[model samples]
Target: MNAPVATSLLHPEFVQRPVPEALVQALATRFGSQCSTALAVREQHGRDEGAIAAPPPSAVVFAESTQDVQDAVRLCAQHGVPVIAYGAGSSLEGHLLAVEGGISIDVSRMNRILSVNTEDLTVTVQPGITRKQLNDAIKDTGFFFPIDPGADASIGGMTSTRASGTNAVRYGTMRENVLSLEVVTANGEVIRTGNRAKKSAAGYDLTRLMVGSEGTLGIFTEITVRLYPLPEAVSAAVCSFPSIEAAVHTVIQTIQVGVPIARVELIDVNSVRMVNAYSKLSLREEPMLLMEFHGSPTGVKEQAEMVQEIAGEFGGNAFEWAERPEDRTRLFTARHNAYFAAVSSRPGCRCITTDACVPISRLADALLDCVTEADASGIPYFLVGHVGDGNFHFGYLINPDSEDERTRAEQLNQQLVQRAIALGGTCTGEHGVGIHKQGFLREEAGDGAVQMMRAIKQALDPQNILNPGKIFTLQ
Candidate 1:
């Protein structure tokens, strides 16, 4: 097959080829002020929230239109130079890093909502538009995009990563939300994958193929996403549990009984402490579940009561309510900022984030074991989860300068992924398999599947010029 692309979780070795001088001149001549070889811009384009420290791209190009993206890709393809798509720069798995060094196409300026079809429950927007921007654009329409990664991330970036968040328990992830895409292929040709229609027995699901490709297959220029009508009633509550296992069991039982919880998140005791400190709140320093229910008022109350009873059986107590809109926003915003809270809890500490998803039956086993291992390691860490879906993240805190700490964290991550796989789970549930999870992806997908992916990559971009050295190394 592809001959075992990566043998380690560390950054892949990339050959740095200088950007062609002729290509640079041509791009500058065409885009003038939109092209930049400045160190500041290149540095900004190079790094993300990932642990890998790859070299920056040789240059950065601001693309304001699909034609702009096509022109840039055409020039880069002509020179056989890599082109990394840049969105909100919030990818956690080194998806945006310019590892092979070529050009970064920043499409943030193309932020425009092209159209909203409330009748069809779909909206078409440029890749540069952020999720919050899209929501704000359609706020008065009584419909909202349900896929939220909580980073104010660009829709393009979210689509590439196939991201999901707390609401994923009910609404589903990007894989379910994205209906179609206008993609600029590696050869600079534009192709539409599907349409705004809800469902069809279509040929191949190209929309899905491009959804989580992380810009390796093609660059998305325009996207159509499914939308949901605003819920008639929404209620949020938080309950603290005596133990992590108890909190997890509560989630499992609630899901098993079919509460249809709109959002159900798990916060470990350590994370709750850090979050309380960082967000300036007085919350119980114990394992907690933050839940939301949506439907008619009676339906919301029924779901909440069922969950409360289930939580009580698992030692959950003192459920607090965030019934007001502002309160709910504050609560969720704090949960979304759990990464920041964990990092700030230890100044100058870098985070090695883990996204492990296991079967609901094995969620407790997986999470409890992980927490026990982290506790045994005596490393500072924080945890948060969308446990209703059996997906969670652990932010392993490490001093940036300490290779020893990094090694320990990587070991713990490996152990967790192995455990999840053994339990019929996945290495990543929401976060895309960027550079970080390349090894685990192979282990999870097998050599045959990986080779199939590599074959597709070669067919689409023979030069390996689009986000090279990501997802897998095409050696």
Candidate 2:
């Protein structure tokens, strides 16, 4: 097949079309076989962990260094080509999709941990290093990065999406942990957005802007993030509730009472069934909440006791707490695999997974409403959530070829997003609005804010070549 097109690429056209063969020739000059004819195949370099409108780019640029990222951006700009930044491709909102058909600058090759500042409790790394790899490198030092999104996602991809997970309740999100970044602007200029200091009264928060920009703003080559000293003592628990609403409510009360939960995830009845059937874990056939606490033995003990008491008040049962390393490992591992189990529950169907976040107070109500409506609508869906942060996912399984099922799924999605917005939450918690949630962004951001964002996009990549048809429309 041929390369894809880029319409208003810096050079002003899609890559697949019959333009000058300049891009291919130039890519061959810089990064030989790393470039691809089918960006779809290269787009496969990194893809959404779950299904969600992922379109491959025209070609893949396997970059080896920060200079490689800079060189490719320059060549693409000179040729008017759209560039889609890619990492582990574990995003959910289809952030790595090159809908405008340009270059998928696959950065996984730049995998290196430059230096570890154990003194400052910070680590500097190339964007390509996965969380697992980074943690493996630093585990010996008793310093670990805590913003986990379940998958072994790349630091760059995680940073771009502002990813957070179970540890968010206690360790905070990418927003709180990222210390600095080396970004490549739309014009191929390399710049540093932040610093090593804990806090800064800088001119503007560009670091925060790039954290969740999801690659639409610029490409990150180097990432500097704050690290945490591993907790001295850790405890894990799996608490069951009569219903998801009850489990969710217990999570709220636990967080409200300042129980210091490291992780508290909601697994609805359907999710429990799927995980059991897939992983053969004979968990109770009811809504479940898997939680963990980090602190000294005395502190964790106190926290777990307080949480159990609060959960008991809300009709939560089976509050099984585990102290041994193996026991805690098994508990969280099972919880992390819940998504894959949900998808594999039904054979031969892909998962269109999406998550939304609301204010902690409104979390229980919104979740109850969405789950009930989805079940009543007879849609094939599963529910999971990091209820500690009021963020949850609805994984829908349907054949894309079947218009009827897709339509019903879309309607359910619209309803869920509307309800989340009504409850003071975002349409997407961390997945982002790549292309799937662009419309919802308007509803969430209002026309005025969207207009300003569009203007910013115009100013940065005027040709709309960076990543077309994402977050906003160009034409």
Candidate 3:
């Protein structure tokens, strides 16, 4: 492993690459009004939900179709300009930043459901379709996509980040659900990585390679993913615990006992209080487990009983069930709004979030230590997690101008990641290694693995024009 280095949450020195005037004029002529150089548009495309600040892209290309993406990419490739793919702009890491100076290919206009193979439980969609949009389109088909990454993120962005949210413990993540992809390479050559087949002994496994590449190797145009039929019966419940340890331990036991939970999330006291104030709901102010079970009525009941018993042993409060669809929706909406609620709690603050996932057996140990440290540091923060999968996040709210706050938050984040790694886990579980987690990525993946990644990046994008200065820096 490379020697550990101090990681900073504050903005790093960004080296801007030149976008020649000739290239700008050519893009305008080719794309007509579809291309934008307006400061507002560029600014919107330049940054994401991540706290890091960087210069906006030189231009933003609003791609409406695969052909549009291809044309834009081809033009940028010819000019040797960096190309950054933009989806819903919901990235929590700096995945959407144009740190190296480039033109952003905005795929949000490409939202469309090309085909739905209900018989085969698969759907092919344009890259810009958001998870909520896709689910709304297929609601009546008796099927739904389960990879909910909290935000209504675009399918392409979700796939690129390998996102998983509350439902991931049971339904798996984008990495497991994505069946195929149509991608535009660095040179603007289009290629199909796989078919709709559920299982393939195909060579190379390129589909997996591109799924979480964070737009480094290629730009995704179309994606085909697995779908599941809606559960015949669904039940949601919440149970508060005396402490985070109790909540997390209950989850560990529940998972180890082989309960097929549909969704399980941990919300610390800080998040619960924020959600109550922001969402106008009266949830108990305690570390809690928000859980769901899906199956036949009898099966769902059995699973809930088992989980509730497990919780009882951990000193958890009685389960508050949300049996009605509306009630369940309201409950989860609050859960999904946790980040926004936390942000709103502290006005004029930016969040430096940490995504660390550990082995199930180490969940309590990994989480408690971080929680204690955060409390001791007196940093305002909120904690939430998909503990059934042993993945959680700490969003430290800090004043942007305060260098001390940023340093402290980054220190907490660095320690959290190191603990996760020491426990046989990853620095990032769902979020990709955007600029924020690059240092931790090196610590986790080691020098040899990162070098291999660099080799792949060079082989695929030799000019280093695709989302350059992300994941890892070129030596």
Best by lDDT: 3
**lDDT string, candidate 2, 1-475, tens digits:** 2343332211323333222477878887778777666634664753666555434565788888888899989988887787888888778766776666678788998889998999999999999999999999999999899988898889998898889987888888988899899999888999998899988997998899788887888999999999889999988888888988788878888888778889988888898898888777788989999888888999999999999998898898887878899988776777788778877877777677778999999998888888888888776789988889999989888775666666677778888899999888999988777767887899999999999987887788776677666676754
* Tens digits of per-residue lDDT for model 3, 159-211: 99999998999999999999999999999899999899889996999999999
Model 3 regions more than 4 Å off: 1-7
Model 1 Cα lDDT, one tens digit per residue, 241-292: 9999999999999999888999999998888899899999888999999999
Clashes of each: 0, 14, 0
What C-alpha lDDT does candidate 2 achieve relative to the native structure? 0.82
Superposed model 2: Cα runs more than 4 Å off: 1-19, 38-40, 50-55
| Per-candidate local distance difference test | 0.90, 0.82, 0.92
RMSD (Å) per prediction? 1.6, 3.9, 2.3
- What's the residue-level lDDT of 217 in candidate 3? 95
* C-alpha lDDT of candidate 3 relative to the true structure: 0.92
Cα displacement (Å) at residue 26, model 3: 1.1
Name the runs in model 1 displaced over 4 angstroms.
1-12
